[model samples]
Target: MMSKIISENKVAQVAKLIDKAKNIVIVCHIAPDGDAIGSSLGMYHFLNALDKMTTVVIPDAMPDNLLFLKGTKEILNYSKYPEFAGELIEKADLIFCLDFNALKRLGEKMEVAIASSKARKVMVDHHLDPEGFCDVTISHPEISSTSELVFRLICRMGMFDLFETDSATAIYTGMMTDTGNFTYNSNKSDMYFIIEELIKKGIDKDEIYTKVFNTNTVDKIRLNGYAVSEKLEVFPKHKAAMITLTREELNRYHYRKGDSEGLVNVPLGIENIVFSAFFREEKDFIKVSLRSRGSFPANKVASEHFNGGGHLNAAGGEFYGTMEEIKERFVKILPLYNQYL
Candidate 1:
């Protein structure tokens, strides 16, 4: 048996909330990744098993690859249907905020909707420095992924019997994707025990991995190739590397939403490179993703410079600047972190 990671009192609070609520809604951050989608759908499945009226809403679109999960069709994207999504949150008796720490993570427009929500909120996440917004905040920064925390919450509430195969597949996909297929931030033995329990639910772990990682389009393949071969910058003294892609460059290759998903982690595979950053140009800002090895503290770099924070090794933030400007800033800041390398 895995050691108890959740307190019994919080579990009781969640159980009581679920027991009384009539309309339930689940929400995740904008640009929802595998963990966001996985944890939301996993909770949706559980609530369905209990005959609870539930809906899953995301601030924006999810990756096409993740469409393979069990309930993608049932999900409502707030960007696409703002009125309907807002209505659900407004009507919900209890809202489960999954995979994100702050209400602002719901994006500017949806943040307004959730902030006004009268529904009692419970946040289950694995991010650090959770804001004091939710009624029951289950944030475990040490856990590999938010899906793991969702799983722990279910078991701690004694609802593991309702945990079915589809939920297992979704949660496992999040765990695998967030950890880069178990390459980083996955040292906990209990994570394996959780995986063992998921396998016992009859989900095919190998198939899930293939579907999430192996199924890439031709455009995505070419985009990644171009990004690495043409844009990758390496600094020998700092043991650092960075890759930047402007909007024009992305459009040239028919860039899709998730095309550059793993680009930041690519540099770490090279010999002696401990830090990697990927900056992809968006409409008004550049999306920043940073990764590092050992004790380099990539999250510090993310929070300090990019207005974001995450795990020590993997973190990201946003910057409102040109690609050239961001690249120069990163290069100028490299010396400050040289000692860590």
Candidate 2:
């Protein structure tokens, strides 16, 4: 039997909230990753089983690689249709903020809209330091992903019988993506039991892995190659590696949203390279993805240097700074964590 990490009181409270809700809107973090999309759509499908009028809203576009899921086409992008997304929030009696603790993670404009909405909000996230915004916050940083929480929450609320294949597929995708396909933060025995349950629901794990990881385009392959061969920098002394890709360089390769999904983890494969960071240039900010192996705390580097917090080995942050400044700051900060060396 799996251990109960979530309190029964919170589960009962969430169940009561779900019982009283009719219209529901689900939102996730900006640049929605697999866990965000998986958890959101998983809950979307689950609520539909109960005949709730549900809508899934995203702050911006996700990588097209995730489009193979059951209901990607049905999700609304707030970046493209601000008014309509706001309308959904306005009409929603309850909103499920999945995979994000702070409303600001939905991007600036969508954050303001959701914060101003009359709908009661519940946050289901596996990130650190949740903000005090949601009425019911189900934040568990130790969990593998928010998708796992979604599964646990449903079973805890006595609705596991309603779960089906579609939800299983999405929830599995979230867990797979968040934990780097169970390579990190997934040593717990109970996690395997959840996977067994998902498999019983008819999710083809191999196919999902192939689709999510192996199905890359020619440009994506070339872009990744160029990023590694040309832009990758290794610090043997620090046992670290860094990759920086600018907007111009990305445009040169016909970049798409998901082109660099696993690029951050590539460095860890190098011998003795325990820490890695990827800096992708965005219009307004630098997108930071950090990864590490063994006892190295990548999240501490992210939290202290970039104002972001997540799991020890995997975390992300955004910085509003120039490329030169980011590089200098990273170099300056590396010595502070040299104790890990």
lDDT, residue 66, model 1 = 99
What are the clashing pairs of model 1? none
Instruction: Give Cα-based local distance difference scores for all models.
Output: 0.93, 0.91
For residue 186, model 2's alpha carbon misses the true position, in angstroms, by 1.3
Tens-place lDDT per residue, model 2, 1-341, is 77897889989888988899989999999999999999999999999999999999999998888999998999999999999889989999999999987877888899999999998889999888899898889999989899999999999888889999999999999999998899888898988999999999999999999988888999999999999999999988889999999999999999998998899999999999999999999999999999998788988998888977777888788888998899888887888888987
lDDT of 1 at 191: 91
Q: Write the per-residue lDDT of candidate 1 for residues 164-276, one digit (tens) a residue.
A: 99989999988998898998888999999999999999889999999999999999999999999999999989999999999999999899999999988999999999999
Query: Candidate 2 — which pairs collide?
Result: none
TM-scores for every predicted model: 0.98, 0.97
Q: How accurate is candidate 1 locally (lDDT)?
A: 0.93
Clashes of 2: 0
Clashes of each: 0, 0
Model 2 lDDT-worst window of ten: 307-316
